[model samples]
Target: MPTPDTRRALFARGTWPEASRIAAVLRLETVGGALLLVATALALVWANLPGGTYEEVRELHLGPAALGLDLSLEHWAADGLLAIFFFIAGLELKREFVAGDLRDPRAAALPIAAAVGGMAVPALIYVAVVSASPSAPAGAATGWAIPTATDIAFALGVLAVVGSHLPSALRTFLLTLAVVDDLLAITVIAVFYTSDLAPVPLLLALVPLALFTLAVQRRVRTWWVLLPLALLTWGLVHASGIHATVAGVLLGLVVPVVRSQAAGGPDAGPGLAEHFEHRWRPLSAGFAVPVFALLSAGVVIGGAAGLADALSDPVALGVIAGLVVGKPVGILATTFVLAKLTRAELDPSLRWVDVAGVAVLAGMGFTVSLLIGSLAFGQGTPAAEHVTLGVLLGSTAAALLAGVLLLHRNKVYRAIEAEELVDEDEDGIPDVYQR
Candidate 1:
């Protein structure tokens, strides 16, 4: 048997959170997901109403203009508040790379492949559909990346409702794939979406970033020291012509994931990353994301004719195809090919059909998709409006389809669960009779 020290060391590896922490985070995200839906609905309704109040609220400029940061309310939500969400994403990415499933090549291979394929196929499908359509705008091709993201909160919330009896491994698979998807989406934002190379601010950003890294590595826990430094880094990054959210990810990654010597041995409770995630996750999910959703998801769907025009638009069709069709095809194909080549078998409780359902669920790209749509085509533009409609329609279709398939799967799993729960006696036998 393993000793207590060994158990402590094992826990210290930080590959995953304690079950309770995961549960807490999931519950919080579920609530956030519901709020996200509410925000999106309100935005849609408010925007489509007769008055122009929604546009005024979204477009109102309020930030300090002197520093060249006077962005509109929507821009602030997209560029400013979204940074908090990215920061939490960065923390999760660091944890996964340092101690989670990604650290294990064997364990991470399938999901990593799935995430890549999922992203790639969607972009290709979008590009193909938009480029081939004569009605597509000149710059419509840039929005190919919009459907490449998978909204974790939204997808998981749907799963919780429709697949309550899904095998535990299926949920793990979805979570891992979504995490990797977020990482890829972040990379896309940094690389493909950046404009105008401002070398000075970009280079200057490193100073604060490096200092932030040093403080966190040395176990400096003071908020005053870190907060200003973080803000400075964000400002420099924003000024550098790079999206400000990249700074959040960089700052998160630099935070030391392992326990320091000052924090006792490996078993001396959670590390700084875990502590920070717990403290910030609620803020990110509850405030940053919902606010962003409210500000971004509101598109004036022009009545029945307008809705028809949007759905028929080449850009919208491309987004719909990319998300609803491409995401699942890419994920399922990649998983199947990799499993065949590697001779790896899935958990006995999971079938390829279950994976397929999860893949379909992954197509529900909401948060990051909307953000990318705004970036690809400036918000409130006709192209942007079409992209918004596509994301909403595509995600809804995927959710409804996945719900049907998963509900059927859930019934099967429930039957199995019932059988497994029959062992009521201490002897591990069904006490069906007094015999």
Candidate 2:
């Protein structure tokens, strides 16, 4: 261990910046997760209350009407604020692809496969359920992708709380899987959800995107220059009928992950990508996401009968089944099959049960699911409301189930940790033998 002064100097020089950055992200996400829960709860209560205040607030529109941007408060939150969250996600994705575990094919294979399985299974299940149900709406098929996403912040937050004693590898696996899940979700939003695509604005978006990429490539870290470019690109993308959040992801991808000579030499510090992530992650997690949740999660549960009706709706039932059942079944089944095929065992510290618990945790599809639900059925419509109810109910169930399972897993991990410590003290004698 270093002396206090040495530690201070190292910190000042950013010697352990990666560890610091990771810790900062984890802390912010945990708090954000808690805030998200609060916002969702508040929305639920406010919407369910006697007053119609929630709908009024959510429907309040403010923006330039001339540019066709006079969107409601809910749209602004979903489309505008969520871009920031996606930007941070894009940065994380780029970092992972460039320098993190995802850079290696061997390390990436399992999570990528699991993510694919996780997405595909839920979608298939949703489509099958919706199609089989005669009561399903005409366009219920579009909502099939709603439950395909895994909320990274919420999932990690739950893991942090319930699996504090679990191996770091488990968290790593979850993060990787979530990242891939987000990528697929983004792609689906871009390809399937876009309507009335204006080619001109879409092409115009390339200009700002290119300039942004060039600036970052040249080590230009000026906020004024980059922010305008990002906004402009987002505007163009928004106008082009694709989801505007995709612009954030593209902007993030363009940023160079590796440091250049202009960025204070090879050993100078973290790259621009890392710097941007550190600066924006707090904004994304603490503000953008929570605000989005407050806006989007407010659904009028009507009453017990209303909730029952929503749950009984085929679309709602499909989302619930997709997230709570299909998600885990797909993820766990894929992992097990891959392990068997490759003859690759899990890490010694982990078990199949732990993976199952995590798979269940992955089913907490809140943010992206809500977004997709809105895109599938017009926001504030009865169908959309039912989708929201399904998402809330499904995600809540997943969280509670995962919490119980992972909490027990955490206890087991703690006991194993104690056994290892005891073994170390007993000259390598096994804990069972010593006992």
TM-score of each: 0.89, 0.90
| Candidate 2: tens digits of C-alpha lDDT, residues 281-369 | 87788778888999899888768888888988999999999999999999998988988898555655567888889999999999999
In candidate 2, residue 432 scores what lDDT? 39
Model number with the top TM-score: 2
Candidate 2 residue pairs that clash? none
- Candidate 1 RMSD to the correct structure: 7.5
lDDT of 1 by residue, 1-435 (tens): 778788767765653367445546634656878888998999899888897999999899986788779999999898889888889888888998898888988878888899999999999999999888898889889998999999988998889888778888888788889999999998999899999969899999999999999998777778999999999999989999888988888889988787655556544556789888887777787778888988899888878999998988999999999999999999999999999999565655678999999999999999999989988898799999999999999999999999999999999878867766446778765543210
Candidate 2, position 112, lDDT: 80
User: Where does the lowest 10-residue lDDT sum fall in candidate 2?
Assistant: 426-435
Q: What is the C-alpha RMSD of each candidate to the true structure, in Å?
A: 7.5, 5.5
Give the per-residue Cα lDDT of candidate 2 at 204. 99
Which runs of model 1 end up more than 4 angstroms from their true locations?
1-27, 260-267, 421-435
